[model samples]
Target: DHGSQYVSDVFQDEIAFLGIKSSPSYVREPQGNGIAERFVRTLKENLLWVRHFDTVEELRLALLEFKETYNREWIVGRHGYKTPAQVRKEQTAPVSIAA
Candidate 1:
């Protein structure tokens, strides 16, 4: 997240392509954004602070791996102890009709 900058058209297009929603923050209240802020903190603690990367490419790849790990293994309390990957799977599961 870039702070308070005009988001680029290309970036918006990419977000739409990836089916990600942009949640706009409320004005002048940092507390209202606690969940996202906590995630940034968690990401830094789990991935960024644990190693020194020699290059941007290395860091990018590491981040991708970290993301996969987080989705597969991280248990979120709000998700009833399920990983993010599990939640996504449940959300996308097909509905069966009773015959």
Candidate 2:
């Protein structure tokens, strides 16, 4: 999102520090955010909805495990049917932001 909170310098610094890519969809273009939206849906369906955690630490651990499993096993069409780990391993293109 290009919303104020997301675009704020504080938020951007945190994202950069964490080494996560910050790619916001073009304004008013929901289609551009499809991948992220799909990820949230998948997370809820595969983990959140089906599991219960008694504590935040337990949930965090579960999420960490889920991330590893997802990156290693999930085949995504957008990545040409490759798991995220595969795609990342093959990635060599330079990163850029579009205006």
Best by lDDT: 2
Provide the RMSD of all predictions against the true structure, rounded to 1 decimal.
4.6, 6.6
What does candidate 2's lDDT look like per residue over 1-99, in tens digits? 677999899999999999989888788888767877789999999999999999999999999999999999999998899999999988966778999
lDDT of 2: 0.92
Superposed model 1: Cα runs more than 4 Å off: 1-32
Candidate 2 C-alpha RMSD relative to the actual structure: 6.6
Report clash pairs, candidate 1.
none
- lDDT for residue 2 in candidate 2, whole number 0-100: 77
TM-score of each: 0.70, 0.71
**Per-residue accuracy of model 1 over 33-89 as CA lDDT, tens digit each:** 787778889999988999999999999999999999989999998789999999999
Taking the candidates one at a time, how many backbone clashes does each contain?
0, 0
